[model samples]
Target chain A: MSATLAVAAAQAKTKTSNYARIYWPFVVPAGLLVFAIIIAPWVFTLIMSVHEWKVGEDPAFVGLENYIRLFNDSRFQWAILRTVYFTTLAVLFPMVLGIAAAVCFHKNFPFRGLARTIFILPMMATPVAVALVWTMMFHPQLGVLNYLLTSIGLPASEWSYNAVSVIPTLVLVETWQWTPLVMLIVLGGLASLPQDPYEAAKLDGASSWQMFRHITLPLVWPHIIVALVIRTIDALKAFDTIFVISNGGPGTASETLNIFLYQTAFAYYNMGYASAITVVFFILIMLVSLVLFSARQKTTFQ
Target chain B: MKMRGLPGKIGFALSVFALISPAILVFLWMLSLAFKNEVDNTAFPPVFIPNPPTLDNFRAVFEKNNFFHYAWNSIIVSFTATGLALLLGVPAGFGIAKSKASKAAALIMIARVTPGLSYLIPLFLIFQWLGLTGTLTPIIITHLVITVPIVVWVMIGFFEGLPAELEEAALVDGATIWQAFRFVALPLARPGVTVAMILSFIFSWNNFIFGVVLAGRTTRTLPVAVYNVLTFEQISWGPLAAAALLVTAPVLLLTLLMQKEIVAGLTAGGVKGG
Candidate 1:
């Protein structure tokens, strides 16, 4: 009621008053929607994490047992380690390839725009769709990949089907899809870069490679960092490709944290345990994001 | 980022082709698979292009599945969600920009930055309780979790870039705050609106996780439909690639055509709305 009166007063005063006074009217809907969808679910996850809950039954209070069990669960531990491993592999290829692509594209060229437009097609393609296409291509016997391998005098190996190779194989798919995204971001940075330093380096008779290493690399470092941060966050939350490709694999080999939490809740119906995983996983992501965000703040985008 | 002369041009061309071929090869492979018969798809050396190209796979995609219904569902859910996001998000973005509310902007960031699965289970349960599962409503509403942030953040950038003097002049003309915003600020942010709409629509259309969890069979969106095609007992590469291609066709065309706008939106948002 008081809020209603305030809104009315703000409206009446709107003709002569400050615009900032009406902040709530503009801000609150998005806030409320976010709260209802993201925040409320988050709080509910917190509550559910502490209880022994499953589908078709009431949640029983379990306190720290779920968290304790999660720590002791070797599979959960493996998921964490595997998630980190996957994130590293996923980010590394994309970063190196993307940066190289950006640098290569940064030079003057014909059909540059058309080539770039084609390059980013993989990134823009639907993730699930991309996974499916790659899954066919990854088939051991009938697939193009093995055919190509034999053509090149290499042995055909089971790709995502092999437990040991699942994560790396999935990372290959990920790199295929997202390297273009990193290229695009880095290219944007490369485009905006001031030319004066390069001119100075040229005047000083610096070699091309030296100009790149000393001049170009330093200026574009911030953009590279931004791409790293973005890719890190993205790679950590990766699901669609991994899910469709391995479905956590021949065993639990490719089951990253996201997949683990998902199966725990949906497949196993261990809601409380899944919720516990959710909290831990969410916190883990938040911590990584926070670290990157702070690092980003120190670099750029402030 | 520009260069001169023949050597530089040749070096650039080689690098560009080497960098770009992986992407082109995969897409071309998908196209080939979509056109090939199942026998040819599994042939020892994969056919680079289908010799007798067939529309049979495309036919199977439409016939074996309710593809058009799912496409319609995708359209309805994304359109409604993107519309609602714009309605709520633009003003919030403007307010956040004008008020210098980094916390609020960060709050929206928190919504999107969290993993989708973290919220999916609970939202699924809530929707079940509300008896809104098996419908488009939940999918549309839940998509706002991600879409609103994209719109709000992108629009905030656009609003920040708009000249303040234009709005100040409107204010000085005895225009109300609402008038100044509706007449002066919003019109100038047209490009931002387009970016927001294209981005939100594309993301919502392509969203797999939310559609997987919340949507029923009839209500399944394109990604979910394509996923269902994959789970069928025998793996038919022809039908599978065809389904995937059909699902991605609209978004791909949009991205290919509006390359500049998408690039601007991407660099500004600095996050994957794809």
Candidate 2:
């Protein structure tokens, strides 16, 4: 027994030493890249927010000026309100539509797989491609959507060009592109459901609606939260679709914080101000994510 | 029973059709628009079926736009990024998983959650300083941000699920640790590798924000190229639709061909059983 134990200890010591050498080579580079790429940029944005500079000029330290300006600026406030509105509309519509679709196809039906695939097609397509297609379909005079509306006796509206319609139009396009993501989450949750409760409900002579209300809704709530949090984060950071479709529009009507930052940093060449906006945007995202995460934790605890 | 059965069947059919109709209609409309000429594209009523469909727009897209170049660029960037990501991420994932490094994993998640543009600008400045702004290197490296985490996260789940007994047995047979991983672990993880490849490729192909801000005219990607077409030309619905369709065609075909794999890739690490 002593001999066997000594041999095992030697093997264990060798294994531990081997693992130490093999592990650091993989961990260190990945760790450094993530830090430089993600975490450092965030810190840089925060630091740059307090400084003032144009593209070529040296950054002049102006403590609290940018934040002060941000608070007093009317356009910035308007952008915040508009972004909140856009995020709300964009997130809610997709959530409701995706849940509806998931519920519809939750059970085994003929061509169910095909139907699910088709629904997910939009999500898989490149966002730029989707935006370009919608841009054509939103043309004022000859676009298919306008023609359909006019044919149905509604007044034809300038979808993308008109200031009144651009934000909502962009929201609709976003919802159309993202609803499939929500459906996928919900479908995963639905599929993982235990069947005993469902079978019990059926034996109790409960209708489909009752079963859905009592069992499905409660069970899928976590999935719904997951979908909402993901969509909210994505929607809050929306840029590519809006950039392609409207370029933030005829006015600043469709401009979110991201668009604001892009235009300020690149187009206007005001890096300091753009950095300020980015810092604020980051904080906003973190706060929203934290709230959602805490709420989820509470529910899980219950 | 018969009366209820008929109603239930009809209700199920109607609901399923309703859920699916929007997507199918949009796809069909895109297809019809791709083949239609200008006159047919804007006829009095929107034609579901274009009378006498033509290939002129497709020809125009190919001939005028150098679309084949853009396609090649996309393939190169996506494949190279995916290849590099797998090389780096798989071993990283295995190390992290074995080490139980949740903090390191959370750091990766932080990278994933932060907005792309926030980091993109600073990186743009850095690339400008390095004089590598226009080349494919910047874009490919930038894309690693998207692809690596995906590969790493998926691979973590895969490696964790794997039995350690195989590697132990290989080690017991006098194999080196690297040999145990290379010979025993990698071959068994082929499905996860496939998932990583398909996903990383799809993401790198679809990504537009980095390409737009970083890429110059010579190195423009398909998504950026398509956006330029929208902004540059007169809004000719026919040619624009044709361009959109042409840009989407390769990816659409890929998704269709690898539908099951793509689905598996997206759902990886999301569900427990999956």
- Leading candidate by DockQ: 1
Q: Show model 2 residue runs off by greater than 4 Å.
A: A1-24, A300-302, B1-4, B269-274
Evaluate model 1: give its TM-score.
Answer: 0.94
Compute the lDDT for candidate 2.
0.80
Give the proportion of true interface contacts each model preserves, from 0 to 1. 0.70, 0.48
Q: Write the per-residue lDDT of candidate 1 for residues B18-126, one digit (tens) a residue.
A: 8888888888888999998888887876777798999999998788778888889988989999999999999999988887788888888776667888888898889
Q: What is the DockQ for all candidates, taken in turn? A: 0.65, 0.51
Model 1 chain A is weakest, by summed lDDT over 10 consecutive residues, at: A15-24
| DockQ, computed on Cα atoms, for candidate 2 | 0.51
Q: Is the docking of candidate 1 incorrect, acceptable, medium or high quality?
A: medium
Per-residue lDDT of B240 in model 1 = 91
| Model 1 misplaced stretches (Cα beyond 4 Å) | A1-20, A295-302, B1-7
C-alpha RMSD by candidate, in order: 4.3, 3.3
Error of 2 at A77 (Å): 1.4
Clashing pairs in 1: none
